[model samples]
Target: MQFRHSLTRCSAAAAVVLLGLAPGLPAAAASSSTIGVAAGANLEGISVYDTADVLNDEKIKDALSSIDFNEPTKVAVFSRQGEYSDDINSETLAFAREEHPEWISQDAEDYGDYWADGYFIITLSVEGHGDGQIGTYFGEDRKVSTSQMESIHEAGYEDFNLSRWTDGVIAVGAKGAKIMNRPWYKNPALWITTGVAGGAAGATGLVVLGVRASRRKEFEANLSTGREHLSNVTMDLDTTELSARTLPTGSRHAADLERRFADFMAKYRTLFARQQELEAATKKTRSSGSGVALSKDFIDTAQQLDATDDAIIAAAALYTRSATWQEAWRAQTAPILEDLAELPELLGGPDKKLGPAGSALRSFADTAQQEVQAVGTDLAAQVIDVDTALDRLSELRKQLTERLDAYAAARIGAYAKSEAEEKQMRAKLRKQRYASTGTRSGGSILDVTSPAEFFWRVSAFNIGYQSAVKAVNSSRQAASSSSGVSTGYSGGGSFSGAGGSSRF
Candidate 1:
C-alpha cells in the first residue's frame, strides 16, 4: 500500500512538471488530449529528447493518446529508480534503454543550472512509468528568452481554457496572435487635409493676384483712351488754324474785278473808233487849197487815234496776266483819264489858222501817246501783285493739311498699342490663376497698389495727348505767321508798282 501511495505522489509531481514545459512540445504530441500521462508543473527534474529521437518515439505518441494534450503539457522524468519489480514491464524498459542509452547514468542536476535559467525541460516516457529515461533539449538561445517564455506560458493557459477541442486535437495554435503593426504613410485623412489646405491657399493667392492685374489693365486702357481723344482734338485745332492762314483773302472777288477791267478796255476801243471816223470826214473835206486847213486837221486827228489804240492794247495785256483784272483796271484807268483831259487844251493854237489847226491836232496826238504809256505800266504792276498772293495761299493750304493728317495717324496707332498691351496682361493673369487652382477667377488680375497711382497714370497720358495737340497748333501758327508775312510783302510790292504806273 505504501508503494502505491509513493507512485501516486510521483505521478502527480511528474504531471505538474510536464504541464510547466508543455508550451515547448512537438505539435503532433501536443495536439492529443485523451492520454493517461502526467504532465508536471514548474518543469522540475524533466528530461528532454533530441529533435531526431523525439520524432521517432512511438511510445510518446501512444502515451499522448490518453492525456488531455489540448492543455499545455510539461513532463518530468527520473533517470534512476529503486530495484525493479515485476509490474515494471521488461520489454518497455528495454526499448526505452535501447532508444535513450545516454539517459541511463545521467546526473540529476537542476535543469536551470545545467542550461540557461529560462530553458524548459522535455521528457520521454514509456508506458506511464515514473522511472523513464530523461534527456535535455536546449531552448533556442537566440529566440526563447526568459521573459518571452513567461509570456508564452501565460498565453497558452488563456488559449487552452477558451478554445474547443475535437478528437483530442487543439482547435487553435499558440502562434496565431503574434503579428506585426501598420505604418504611418497610409493614413488617407492626413494626405487629404494637406492637399485641401494647400489647394485653398494657392487658389486664394491666385485670385488676389488676378484681381490686381485686372485693375491695372483697366487703368491702362482708360489712360490710352484719354490720350487718343486729346490727340485728336489737337490735330483738329491745328488743321483749322492752318486752313485759316492759307485761305486766299480776295480770291472770290478776282473774277468780278477781271470783268470790270474788260469793260473798260471796250470803252477805250470805242473812243479810238470815233477818232478814226472824224479823221476820214476831215480828209474828204480837204480835196483843194481851201481844203489844206481841213487836211491838216484830219492828219493830226489820225495820229491821236493811233496813240489811243496803242493804250488800249497795253491795257488788254495787263488784264490777261492779273488774278483779278479789276485791280489792274483801277491802277491803269486814272492815268489814261488824266492824259485825255489835257489833250484838247494842249491842241489850242496861233499860226496861219491852218498852222494853228495843225498844231492843235499834233498836241492831241502827243497827249494820247503819253496816256497810253501810263495805262500799260499800271496794268502790268497790278497783275503781278494778284498772282503773288494766290501762289502763297495755295502753298500754305497744302502744308497745313499734310501736318494735321500725320499727327492724327500717330495718335491712333499709339492708342491701338496701349489697348493691345492691356489685353495681353489680362490674358496672362487668367492663365496664372488657372494653373494655380484649376479654376478661373472673376476679378481684376493685375497688382495695382492705389487709386492715386491709377489716376496719375491716366492723367499723365491725357497731358501727353494735350501737349502733342498744343505742339501741332504752335507749329501751324508759326507756319502761318512766316508764310503770311512773305505773301503780304510780295503782294504789296507788286501792287505798289502797278499804282505808280497808273499815275504815269
Candidate 2:
C-alpha cells in the first residue's frame, strides 16, 4: 500500500530555516581549509540489509540517514530485503504466495525477494528467527542465517543484531572489505563489478571499504582538535588588538607584539571549555524534544558562535599584519619620516649645496617619506579589517537571535499544518491496509469472508506462490510479482552488487 502524502508548505521560512541547515554567514576571516577528508570518499562500498521489521523502526532509519550510497562516494549502496521469521503458517503463506508469484521461498514459509542488479545471498536460521542471535553464512551454509553474524563476532567484532541495522550493514561491508583488500586475482568480484572481469557470469560482487569503529573515533578526535586550534588562534588575535590599542606611538616592536600573542595563547585554554559547553547544551536541547523553538535557538546560536570564532581567527591574521608594519615603522621607517621633516629646513639653510650628495639626500628623503606613509596606511587598513570582522560578528549574533524569536512565534501554525499532514497520511494508510487485507477478520487469513476481498487477495496469493521465480525487469511485471506491490521492496532493486554473492 502506497500512501501519497501532500505536505502543504505552510511556512517556507519555517521549512527552510528549521528543516534545512540555517543560512550561514561566512566567517569574515574564515580560512579555506577543508574540515577533514570524508572517509566515505575512500569507502570501498556500502550495503543496506533491511529486514521487514526495520522499515517500522524509526531509530534504525534515523541511524541509516548518514550513510548515503547514492552519491559518488567510493561506497556503493546496495539495498537488500532481509527475511524475518513471523508465525504465519501454510494457509497464510499460500495466500501471500498466490498474490505475488515471482517471490521465491527460502524455506517452507520464508519468501525471498529477488533482484538482478546486485549480489544476493539467502541466509536462513539467522540467530533471531526463533532463538535471538545474529549470523550470516554463504554457499552451502547460506541456509544458516547466523553464519555471517557469528563469523563477524568470532573475528573479534561486536555481535550483530537486527535492531542495529546500520551496524549489520557495516558487518556485511567488512566481508566485502576482506575480499577487496585481497590481490586482484583474489577479488574477481571487484574485477567484474568494475568491468574488468569481462564475460564472467558470477563475478558480480561489491568492493566495500568498511570503516572500523576505531577509525571513526580517531577521525572525530582529529576534527575536534582542528576546530579548537582554529578557535584559539582567533581569540589570540582579538586579544592582540587589545594590547595594540594601548601601545604608545613609536613604542610598538615585534618583541612586544609577540609577547602579547604569547599571553593570549596562555588564556586560550578556557575557550575550548566554553566550546565544549556549547556543544553539550546543543546536544541536550536536541535530545530533550523541546520542540522547534529550542532546537532553532540552539542551531542559530551555534552558527553565530562559529561565525564569531572564525572572525576572531581572521582578525588575528589582520592583527599580525598590522604588527609587522608597526615593527617596521618603529625600527626603520620612523627615522625616514623624521628625516623628511628636516629636508625643507636643510634645503632652506644657508649652507645648502646643489651638489650630487645634496640632490641624492633630497631624493632619499622623498622616497623614505613615501615608504613610511605607505606603511602607516597599510597598518591602519589592517586595523580596520580586524575591527570590521568583530563588528560583523556582533551584528550576526544579534540577527540570529531575532530570527529565532520570529520562528518561535510562528511555530504553532507550522505544527498545526504538520499535524494535519500526519492525519492525512494515517487515513490513507488505514484505507489501503483494510481495503487490501479485508479488516483482519477473525485474526486469521483463512477466515477472510468478503467475496470481493477474498478473490482479490487470492489472486495476489497466486502470483506470489509461483515456483519458478526470476527477476522481473519492468515495473508492470514487478507490481503483480508482490502481494502488496508498493508496500515492500517493489520496483526498488538496481544493479550494483553489494552483499554476499547470489546466483539466480
Candidate 3:
C-alpha cells in the first residue's frame, strides 16, 4: 500500500511539472504584497565569477571572505562560483537539483525560491549578458539589468586595467551587494485612504509610519466611506456658500442637523434623569440609619459625569444653524471662489467665449477645484472626529450608570439587618436601577482624564472600567491610523534586481 501511495504521489508531481512546462502555460508573475513575504528576514548574497580576472585577484577574494553571514538582519557573502547560467550549465542549478530536487525542477522559476526556502541564491555574474537573464528564469520576479552590470563593470574596469585589482573587485562587490540586497517592506503601520468614487476597495497608500499589521479589504472600505462622507459634506457646504446671496429662510440641512441634535439631547436627558433618580434613592436608603453611608467621592464623580453630558449637549446646541464641519467648508469655499472670480470671463459665460486667457483661467480653475476638494477632506475628518467623540460619551454614560448601580447594591447589602433582608434590598435596588437606566450598550467609553483616582475612588469597579476604556482608546488609534490613501510602490510588493547588474 505504501508503494502504491508513493507511485500516486510521484505521478501527481510529474503531472504538475508537465503542466508548468506546457508552452501556453502562463508563468507565475511576481507576487505583490503591501507586506513583503521576507520583510524581516536577513539577506544572504552570492557571487559567481566566470572569468580568471576575479579568481586572480586576492583583494577581491579577501573582501568576499570578510563578510559575516551569521547576523539576524544583515547581508553576508555566501559563495563564489567560476561560471554561471540560468539553465543546467550553472553550478547553482546543479547544486539545487542535487540537493533540493523536490524544490528545483525544469518548471521552477526564479532562484529566489531557494532563497525563500533558506538558501542564499543571489548570483553575481562575471559576464553580464547571459547572467542578466538568470533572475528572469531563476529568481522569483527579480529583474536583472544589463545597463547596471555595464556601469558597475566600467567602474571596476577603470581601476582593474591599471592593475588596481583589489580596488576593482571591492568596488564591483560593493555595488553587487547593493543590487542584490532584498528590500524589506517592514513598515507595519500603513495609512490607507479611499478614492473619489468611495467604493471600499478603491483605496491607495497615503502615509507610512511605524510598522502596523493591516486587514486590507476591511480597512479600505472604512477609509473610503469616511472620505466619501467628507466629500459629500464638503459639497453641501460649498453649495450653501455659492448660494449665499439667496435668503433661503429654512434650510433642509440645518433642519436635518437639528433633528439629530434633538435626538442626542433626548438621550442625554434620559441618562441624566437616571443618574438623579439613583442618587436620590440611594440617599434616601442611607438616611434610614442602617449603617450605610454612600461615598462622597463617588457622588462628586457622578456629578462630574453629569457635567460632561451637559458640555456635550452645549456643543451640539452651538451648531444650531450650521455645524462647525459645515461652516469650515463654507469658509474654505469663499477663498476658492475668490480665486476663480477673475476667471469667470475666461470660463466663457453662455457665449462659450474662452478668450486668449482661456487656457490659463482653465488651469487656475482646476487648481482651485483641487484646493476645494482638499478643504472638503479636512471637513470630513472633522465630521468623523465629532461623531467618534459623541459615541465615546455614550459609552462613558453607560459605564458610569452601571457602576452607580453596583455601588448602590453594595451599600444596601451592608445596611441589611438579616441575610434575607440583604438579598431583598439588593434585588429591589437592582430592579429600580434597571427601570431607570433601561438596556445597556456593551461598548466602552474613551477615558479622557489621566490620574482617574482624582475623579473617582480606586475601587474594583473603577479599575475594570478603566481597563475597558484603555481598550477602546487602543481601537480608536488603530482605526485612525488606517484612514488615508496609500500612494506608490506599496502594491502589495514586487522584486527586481536594481541592487546590481552587469554585461560582458
Candidate 4:
C-alpha cells in the first residue's frame, strides 16, 4: 500500500510536469503577409545565425502581442553540422550587423573549436512592443548542447510573460484558467461543493481576511476609546472637585469673612495697647487731669472694645460654614482647649503682681480670663459641627475619585484600541490593494495599487463617526447638568435678624 501511494504521488507529479510543458492554445495567428527576416555573424570560421520565422509563428506572435517589448530580444541555438546548408545569405547577415552592433563573435579555435559548427539564432523586435519579444535559435550542427538552447528560450519567455502582466494586461495563462474553472481541485471542495465554487472560495477568503483584520482593528480602537474616556473623566473630576474645595462659596463671601476677622483682631489689639498707654498717661498727668483728656480717651477705648467684641462674634459665626475653617477647627480644637485650661492658673498665680496700677490691673486680667474661657467653650462646640461637615466632604471626595479613576481607565483603553484599529486598518488596506487591479478607466500613470491609502481612508471615516457620536452625547449631558439652579450667599451677612451668618 505504501509503495502504491508513492507510485501514485510520482504519477501525479509527472502529470503536472506534462501539463506545464504542453503548448498553450494560440489566440489569433499572425497575418501571412507579416515579414520575417534572418541574419548571421561569422568571425574566425565561427558562425552565428539569427532567424525570424519562430517569432512570426501563430503562438509566438500571440504571446508577443500580450507583452510590451522596449528592449531588443536575443536567443541562442545549438545544433549539429548537418542542420545548416553551405549557402549563407550575406544580406541577412548585414541586416543583423546593422541592427545589433553589440553582438560579439568569439574564436571557436580558442575554446578547442567547441561552437565552430553551424548555428541559427532568431531575434525579434516588434515595433510598439514595450517589454514582450520572443526569440528562438536552432543550431545547424551539434556545436552547443540542447540544454543551452532550452535555457535561453525559457529565460526569454519568462521575462516576456512577466513584463506583459506587470504592464497591466489581464492575460490568463493555462494555470490561471484551470484554477478559475475547476472547483474540485481546491482542497476545500472535499468537504463543500457548489457551482461558482472557485470564485466563491476566493471571494470568501478575501472577505474573511478583511473582516478579521477589521475586527482586530475595532477591538484595539475600543480599548483605546475606553482609556481616553477614563483619562478625561478623571481629569475633569479632579479639576471640578479641587475647585469646589479651594474656591470659597462665593467671591464676596470669602473676602468679607477675611476682612471682618482682620478688622476685629486689629481693634482688639488696639484696645489692649490703649489700656497700657492710658496707664502710662495717667502716671505722666499732674494730680488734676490736665495734660490729656483722660475721660474722652477712656470712653473712646471702651467703645472701640465693645464694637470689636461684636465683630468677633459675627466673624466667628460666618467662619463656621467655611470648609477651610472647619478643617482648621477640627485640627486645632484639642490644643486650643489645653491653652484655655492653662490660662486660669497662669492668671491667678501670686505673680498677679500688676505693675504700678495694682487694683485696676487685677480687674482687667480677671475680665480677660473670663472672656478667653467663653471663647474657648464656643469654639469647642463649633469644632464638633466642623468635624461632621468635613467627614461628609471627605466621603464625597472619595466617591468622586473612584468614579474618575474608573472613567480614566476606560478612556485609556479606548485610546489604545483606536490606535490599534488604525494599524489593522492599514494592513487591510494593503491586502485590498494587492487583491484589486487599481487601474482607472483610462490608461493613465496615476493608476496605483496602494493598500495603505485604502486602509487609512476607511479607518479615518470610522474613527470620525464614532468621535462625533461621543461628542453629541457629551454635549447633551453637559446641557442637562447646566439646567439646574444653585443658590449661595453673596457676602458675609446674617440670613435672619438674629446673628446667623452663612459662608461658603
Best by TM-score: 3
TM-score on alpha carbons, each prediction: 0.13, 0.17, 0.21, 0.17
lDDT (10s digit) by residue, model 4, range 1-504: 999999977765554343342256231222112211112211112122324222223343344334321112332321111112111122223343465322323354333211112323433332233332323322223222333333333434443444432211112221111122122223234325333545887999898777656554443343344334333333343332333234344444334433434454455455456445544543224123332344344444444333323322322333444444433333323222333344344335443343333333334335534643454456556653422432333333233224323322333343334554444434433444333322211111111111222211222223433454455456556755442211222221221000011000
Off by over 4 Å in 2: 1-389, 408-412, 415-504
- Candidate 2 lDDT, tens digit per residue, 215-325? 334434433554545454564555535644543333223233334344444444554454454345543332333322443333333333333333323333344555443
Estimate candidate 1's alpha-carbon lDDT, on a 0 to 1 scale. Answer: 0.32
Predicted candidate 3 versus true structure: per-residue lDDT over 212-240, tens digit per residue: 12223323333344333333333343332
- Clash count of each predicted structure: 38, 30, 30, 49
Give the alpha-carbon lDDT of every model: 0.32, 0.34, 0.36, 0.33
The predicted structure with the larger lDDT, 1 or 3, is 3
* TM-score, model 3 to reference: 0.21
Per-residue alpha-carbon lDDT of model 1 for 1-504, expressed as tens digits? 999999977764554344343365543432224322244222223242432232223443334333332223333222223132222223223433567433222334432112222222322222222222222222222123223323323333332233211111111112111200111222344347545866998899998777656554443343344334333323343332332233343543333333333453454345345334433543223233334433343333333222223233323333244354454344333332433444344333221133433344445446545644444454355544533433332233233223322332344344323554434333433333222221011111111111211111112223444444454556556754431100011222221100000000
Candidate 3 stretches greater than 4 Å from native: 1-124, 127-251, 267-504
